[model samples]
Target: MSQLFARVVRQAIATFDRKNVASFNKNFSVLKQLVDQLTPCDINLNMDLTTDEAFSRVGKAPVTYVNLMEDEEFEFSVFILRSGFTMPLHDHPVMHGILKVMSGSAMIESFTKEEATGSAGQQLLYDPDAVRIEVVQDEPRLCTNNDESVVLTPTKRNYHEITAVGGVAAFFDILSPPYDSNIPFYGRRKCSYYRVIPRNGESGKRTLERIPPPRDFYCDRGNYEPPDFLRA
Candidate 1:
């Protein structure tokens, strides 16, 4: 690992290991700063692969991932997307995430589950069995390496879809308190996919329906090689 990436990992460990909210926030800020400074050169990313010609040659899969590290506290990985390929909208239940683009560019669309509220101070009914949810959608953003890192908390902007922009794109992702059976309270937190439910004469309200993972979407594993700047 590069010195910068190692520092990021250490800070992430420190942040997630904290029991106090203030301490965790402090460490998380530091972690984000470190991650924001990262670039393709830091991870020794193969810039050659992030091009149209190169993608056509070796990229059989629409998406690929390199697992950097994972533990009880967090999972770190890099995801690469081919041009025009998209990762469908998905939610990260009770987790925190940070994503930083490393190469090329991508478009990100995010959404958050809506809170139950009424017009006249009365609580609205929330139906869990409906298998559909009202969500607040954020404006789509085009992200590149120069852009600030994107963040998602447990409740805010917890679901998102990512698509490669002009060419092949790659990004580093850090998910804290990873989705696993070991998670407390929420047992076996697994990723869930969603599709937009068309609004019938509803102007402002947007809804999403739970769906099975897209059969056409799959990721192939790629080898991760640490940068030459440092060794672990």
Candidate 2:
């Protein structure tokens, strides 16, 4: 399975054609097919933490990530979320991602950034003063094993929130250009959270508002141990 995933990533990277958007579509299509084949048992996961009762403590981690491979080209991770827990609505910045449920299930709410009042027809990237001026609309959906969602560049479905449904859910996550941008002039490449609220005084209108993530929502780290074949 690891080797298969590696091939998928390799093909995904190879399909990265900056001159065309078709490459993005093709790469994501490849990843969706590959991710659908993964499951929690593939990594020896014991599903469902909701019944434990001890999981909701303030200092406890509601989610944990096991790294499969995170390099300059791509990142592969397995996210094990406790039942009833949530990973708040967040943006992937500039990235392409594919997520597939491995065990149990989850309800995923997805969104795409839209031109706001000030930046109509343009994306106000890294504009601290222009955030409130931009707008976004939410498109919600539910997903389970084999069910998937893909995020495309140029601000297409870049934000989402995930909730484990029925019981503990684990999913195979794949991200391209793996979340690291500590360079000068560019905002640090990291996850940013948000909330959907009425556009200030417009009671009938709603849009995304950036906010800090809940402190208690942090994840405990874990080591990667894929099927031995990939290691060999």
Candidate 3:
């Protein structure tokens, strides 16, 4: 790994290794700074590929991913979205995520679940067959290589939908305590999709209903070759 990316990986391990909240926060702050300074060149990613060339190499998949590294503590990968394609609304159950756009641009819309307020909240219906929950949606933002990285915690802005704008886009993604089937109380740390439920006349109330993953969306694995800079 490049020195910059190696530092990022070390910081990620340090951040997640902390049992104290204060220590984790301090380490995570440093991790964020390192992530912010990263660029496509850092990984020797080619942002200049023509659409035809990209499709020829990765096939016609709407999305393609190249896994860089993974361990019990974290998984680092790169996801590339075809033009006008979307990753759909999804939640990273009990995980912390950092996303930094490396090429092109993308629009990100994120949401955080709202805490129950009172008796009404307590009485809200929950069916394992059809799960739904109230959430606060953040304003949609366009992200580019120059934009600061986006961070999501287990509780805050934990759900998001990402769409490629204009043309193809790629972003570096890091998830700490990477999804696993052995999370104690949480059962499996699985990814779940959601759909926004219309609020009718209720102001400030938005609901997200769990849904099956879209049939049209699928990710294909891309060939991950070490960057040319690394060879040098």
Tell me each candidate's RMSD, in Å, in order. Answer: 4.0, 4.1, 4.1
Top candidate (lDDT) = 1
Which pairs clash (backbone N, Cα, C closer than 3 Å) in model 3?
A: none
Q: Which pairs clash inside model 2?
A: none
lDDT by residue (tens digit), candidate 1, 1-232: 5678768877887889847557877888888889999987776676665667655755467887787788888988889999999999988877789999998899999987777655766443333244787887877889999998999887778889999988888999999877763564356667778898757786645798989899978888776676543344
TM-scores, one per candidate = 0.86, 0.76, 0.86
Candidate 3 lDDT for residue 99: 95
Model 3 root-mean-square deviation: 4.1
lDDT of 3 by residue, 48-134 (tens): 442536766534788888887787778888999988889999887777889999988999999877764345554221222438878
Off by over 4 Å in 3: 18-22, 46-52, 56-59, 116-130, 227-232
Evaluation by lDDT, superior candidate among 1 and 3: 1
TM-score of 3: 0.86
CA lDDT, candidate 3, residue 146: 94
Query: What lDDT would candidate 3 get against the real structure?
Result: 0.79
Tens-place lDDT digits, model 2, residues 1-232: 5465566656666654444455667666776776666556654444443234535667668887778766665777878788888988877766777777776778887776664323355444444333442445555667777666444453666778889887777777777657774433445577777777767775434577778787757888655556654465
